[model samples]
Target: MSGTKPPSALSSVKITFLGTASAQPSSTRNHSSLALHLGGDVWLFDCGEATQHRLQKSSVKMGKIQKIFITHTHGDHIFGLLPLLASRLNGSGGTAEGVEDPRLHVSTGENTQPLEIYGPLGTRAYVRNGLMYTHTLLGAPYVVHELRFPTDPLGDFTTLPRNAAELPTGRNIDQIDGHWPDVFADNLVTVSAAPILHSVPCVGYVVNERPVPGKMDPKEYIPAIKRTKTPMSVMSRLQQGEDVELADGTILRGPPRRHGRKIVILGDTYDPSPIAPIAMDADILIHEATNAHLPGIDPTTKEEDTYETVEMKARSHGHSTPQMAGAFAKRIGTKRLFLNHFSARYAGDDDVNAETAEVMNAIGSLAAGEYGGEVTCSRDLMSIDIQLPK
Candidate 1:
């Protein structure tokens, strides 16, 4: 549980933190950007300056970023979107405006998946107006869906998994089911989005594991013991979640199953209360701590104006502090609270040696420590690998 490495590019579901600094840039950290590696593509969360450059520095292929989800339109949140899109299009044999792929590398797969972009109301303006004069065009093999909404649904799973399937499969809306959204799955991970309270319109994302029920172990099955037609018939029943009806009127039962791990990353938020249910018992919680203080509007006393004491700067701006981050992690019962968007507090000092203690006093270490969880500050190009807890 303590020793795990980030998955390689060949992995089906993985996440990489491209940049973890806050609004300002420093030597140790950049801004806020994360790459979600699923199926064969990387879905970007936020694009700060040098985001595409960071992608090149890591193992993520620029071609794999088929989708990009922006939380808000702040310069810290979106400065790199135009540049990254341009580089990707420039590299893919096209100018940057929209996607247009003449030739694609396709295996003997059952489906063709298109690229998609989802963001706040001004997303089209950023693409059509701001980047339109850049002489860049998209040349992918499939469709390029660009959507802009006034408000994002906060912490809702009903539409997220379904949309991820649809944008790739070209399935009709009537056929899409909120109950299950794997209709267009291509060996990819499931991603869900919800709205969070920030200074602007922001959304948080949760990436879940869709079971490869197709790859379950066959050696432990009773059907492998039997011969002839009955054995094959029994195997089908087990996979389909059906009870085996025996010739002698006896039945063989199937056991219930457990779920894989989940990772939640809230781009930048003011209301973490809604995240409790979404991140309940999550393996890891990687949240942005932009503001270091809690938020409140009080006229009576100093304590009335604050909700958290994780940082001092958050008192004026709406951001999270290390202490506030710990409170949210404790409430959600996460395995670990990886604090990114670090201020200049650590200042090149090793957190394992000094920063951890500062954070414990700033926020309560007892909160995160109760469940064997910890607070690890993110550094530039640092990789945290999550594996199944043993």
Candidate 2:
């Protein structure tokens, strides 16, 4: 079999919600974990408590998870890391296969690849303690990158560290670019992170696919090369948007490729303003909506929520309300916004569906009505296929 394969359609980015609960897990919603499906590989964000079990129930492939991005050091956001890593180190349980993509099976033994974790400065210590206490061993090698924001009291996270402190050795990861701090990059996509406002140090991530090569008209080239009998291998180069030399010394130029999709996924945050600029015009924005209104406070009542009331209720907790999340989405102008990290109170009495709908309607009514974008609530195991530009 040929090892070389044609480039995939990177335009299609799928997001799978593994766990979407806030600090406490409700009857239905688990702790927060989201999987970004980029072709065959999966990029996970915010593996909260019981996330490994959530992954076990979902279609997300544990073996194919190339990178794990932690928003902060909060237990609700990161308590599940060590166990998940241990599961990966050992293999997918007894013939357990991928639910969505059947081709994705647990590749054990020699098939394992290096798993990388990206998070704030204290992440190294957090993971180290988890491993030490649990006494977990790993078959697949892993690396941790700790991103630190400026410590100056006056300075917010406007300026972020270019490179993270690589774990074990506590050295910095080699910088890929002078201007943009590159966290990870492959032929399919590039991942980058920036600091966002939360009670703790939180990082928001952006994943962008590489440019796709433009289509080549075989009808135009085939007839012209009929007399010369050009090989199919040479034609492959032309299809890849490369300039090809014909037997008659004529150069066949290929068209410029199209740009792929751009997505932004943020962690738990009270303030979304810091991430708004970075998420500007994104194809999709996954932001936390930890506050929907105190239970029994009817989400539709605008009169009840005076500025002081909301600030005193939600802001002090380092969490964003549906209104705050919506306003932020409006300001950022993301094409689509997904409200995640629901506070357990929203799902009062185990009516998660009704509560989620109420929250979505409340947020959608606020942001999408005024901002001209789409707003939807995310639930565990819900998958959204991102529609990209042509």
Candidate 3:
């Protein structure tokens, strides 16, 4: 599972990792950034430094990003926000030579739909200050949504779900269902957020697609079609689960549809336990593995910190290790786990390779042997296609 090639972008939910490094940048890995291809729209998560440059290297168009979700106000996570916004507003993401470059704009003319940015309390302040300090003139439409817990940090949290139907019911809240922040949702998909323990206020996101309609049994319909001589035009309606009356007054019913895909994307966090329930049965879990050691392992026992033992630094920094990510995915019962947000020390050196090998093997073994799932170490520009349940 660690090195398996991802499927094509045609899948219903395609996740592309743009930046897999943590606060520090390595030659090969940039900061933290991820792109979620939902239908034709693109949603970004944690746009780190040089994320626009990272986007230029990927197939995703920056202009197509409708919403940007920031996990927290950490510099590594939100540093690229201002520049990315400026590019979109000034049309700098457009092609200068009219060539088919990945950096070129996919949309032409003025964008009518305002780009919506969602994040915790400090997000609006950070964006506003960055724009003011940089003296950048914004010409494109945009909006910022600040998320907050309704009562407590673990209580009802605010989000901008595309549809009202996606909101959790009052009964569910009363039952103290895992606090899933209602994020943006649409007719086909629902995105939720949840708080995770970190040095600052941080949140994780989940994208769940609606179940698709089941295919009609042609054999069952064929008999009715022969008996009633039903018109071929009504076949489409019958398959859509509509009770269609045939030419001879025969009624045909459709079957229940299948469930859709579910994906969970997290930010830089130390304790991801709060998201366990919300991530239950998720198709994919994108989590941070900033260290190579297991959870609770202190890499700082020695007076001087070395590359060989950095787990202690991760613990002090409120970040998770590969084992922690694997363990969390297993507890949540997710099918696939992608570990990212790796420290720069593990970028492309022999020491890092050895460390990564050890970490990956440990994650895979633990996920399968203990947690009943699979784990993969994420890399820059890695594309994973999330297929709908068969």
Best of the candidates, lDDT: 3
The global C-alpha lDDT for each of the candidates, from Candidate 1 onward, is 0.56, 0.69, 0.71
TM-score of each: 0.67, 0.79, 0.77
The candidate scoring highest on TM-score is 2
Tell me the tens digit of each residue's lDDT in model 1 across 1-390.
123221212244566778877777666567778887665667888888888778878888888788777777788778898777656654233335765444223221456544556555555446544444543444332222332233333332122222111224322211112111221233335655555667776656666664422323556565533532355556654553345656555565533333555777886765666546566777778876554331221122255344434344463455775556777787888877777765543332344446434542343343343334677666555666666443
Cα lDDT tens digits, model 3, 21-132, are 8889898788999999987889999999999999999998988898898999898999998899888766333344756543222232343466778887767657666665
How many clashes does each candidate structure show, in the order listed? Answer: 23, 0, 9
Model 2 clash pairs are none
Decreasing lDDT order of the candidates: 3, 2, 1
Candidates arranged by TM-score, highest first: 2, 3, 1
Q: Please give, for residues 76-95, the per-residue lDDT of candidate 2 as tens digits.
A: 98988878887876622223
lDDT for predicted candidate 3 compared with the true structure:
0.71
CA error at residue 250 for candidate 3, angstroms: 3.0
| All models, RMSD in angstroms | 9.4, 8.1, 9.4
Better of 1 and 2 by lDDT: 2
